[model samples]
Target: MLLVAPGPFALARTFVFRRYLTLRSHVVRPVAAPPVVDAARKARKLLKKRAKEERLRNFFGWCEGCGAYGSIF
Candidate 1:
């Protein structure tokens, strides 16, 4: 059997090609950020909740002592 020694440039080229293949295989993509809630949408939801509570309080008599709507029979 004959032993063949690889040249310095051959080893360096192999290293560079291996490194390039590894880097190309594993690619990192930019991720999107989480969605944000604007103030107007928050305000609208708050107003809707307040209106619902107000309507419920009106339908059922408000109990100041309990701090909620209470029914009196």
Candidate 2:
């Protein structure tokens, strides 16, 4: 119905002739992930892993700086 017709006849040709970019046919960007995003993602993962490791280590012993198990519980 409405989807088959354009708002104006002039626009129909423009729409038909336009080089539409689909998911697979997109103009290639410089890089999908920028250097900063790649670095940040890596840093975030590393920090998360380190935090888990630190928590495990503190559980086994204790962190004097954080005072995780000194007394307050």
Candidate 3:
């Protein structure tokens, strides 16, 4: 595997690449980084939760405590 040789010029190029490049700008930056996540993953989780709630609502027609089989229309 190719390695970064230990030298002043090598270190300078590394610094410039890290500082100016789009991909590694954060590598040079010091900040409170936000957590990276996929929105589609969250959406899928919410969709699953809503679907489960709908199924439960259908199964239990009315208030479980009262045992009233009334339509919530």
Candidate 4:
């Protein structure tokens, strides 16, 4: 059996490759939504939630005492 160590160029290439991988992994990516976009998203979410509650209220009945929808099924 024969063993050979990596040459200087091979070591440098490996170092650069490892450094590139580290830099790529440590990159900070900002995921920020604009205020207007955030507000619109919240509004859409609220509307969807309200629509779901309304559907449930209509399918069941609004209990005036408990202030919740009555489940018939």
Candidate 5:
């Protein structure tokens, strides 16, 4: 609603208005996995793979040396 009033000067005028605002509920949602978490997961997988390869290498090396060291291969 608006109300207009005339002022003393010919070109001067005042305006009055009323504004009504209604509040409503908003929905909240979950976000996807963070970048840091994904990076950490990838790093963990790579480390595990590297550790497994090292273990296998050590085991084979030990096996190759067993017969020459007077132990069962």
Candidate 6:
């Protein structure tokens, strides 16, 4: 087999390519969520949770002593 060693420019190019590959593989990009968007998401989640709790309370009634929803009688 003929072994031809890479020249300086070829070595540099290989190094740059390897670096690019490494960066591409290792870099983790987070999903972009601005503060306003994040706040709106949190508000929506809170509203949904509150609505669920209200529904459950209406159906099962709230237990004062146990501080939980009462059992279905």
lDDT by residue (tens digit), candidate 6, 1-73: 9998878699789989999998887676555569978998999999999999999887665445345545644
Query: Candidate 4, residues 1-73: lDDT per residue as tens digits?
Result: 8899878699789989999998887676554669978998999999999999999887666445345544533
Off by over 4 Å in 3: 1-37, 62-73
Cα lDDT of model 5 by residue, 1-73, tens digit: 8887656663432221111111111223444469977998999999999999999999999877885688543
Question: All models: lDDT?
Answer: 0.73, 0.72, 0.72, 0.79, 0.67, 0.79
* TM-score of model 3 (CA atoms): 0.35
Count residue pairs with overlapping backbones in model 5.
Answer: 0
Cand. 3 Cα-lDDT: 0.72
RMSD of 3: 10.9
Give model 4's TM-score versus the native structure.
Answer: 0.39
TM per candidate comes to: 0.34, 0.38, 0.35, 0.39, 0.44, 0.39
Q: lDDT by residue for model 1 over 1-73, one digit each (tens)? A: 9998877699789999999888876665444443434665778999999999999887666446445545542
Candidate 2 structure, TM-score to reference:
0.38
Total clashing pairs for each candidate: 0, 0, 0, 0, 0, 0
Q: Which stretches of candidate 4 lie over 4 Å from their true place?
A: 1-33, 62-73
Which ranking of candidates, highest TM-score first?
A: 5, 6, 4, 2, 3, 1
Candidate 1 local Cα displacement, residue 68, angstroms: 16
Q: What is candidate 6's local distance difference test score?
A: 0.79
Question: Among these predicted structures, which one has the highest TM-score?
Answer: 5
Better of 2 and 3 by lDDT: 3
Worst 10 residues of 4 by lDDT: 64-73
> What C-alpha lDDT, on a 0 to 100 scale, does residue 16 get in candidate 1?
97
- Residue pairs that clash (backbone atoms under 3 angstroms), model 5: none
lDDT of 5 at 31: 49
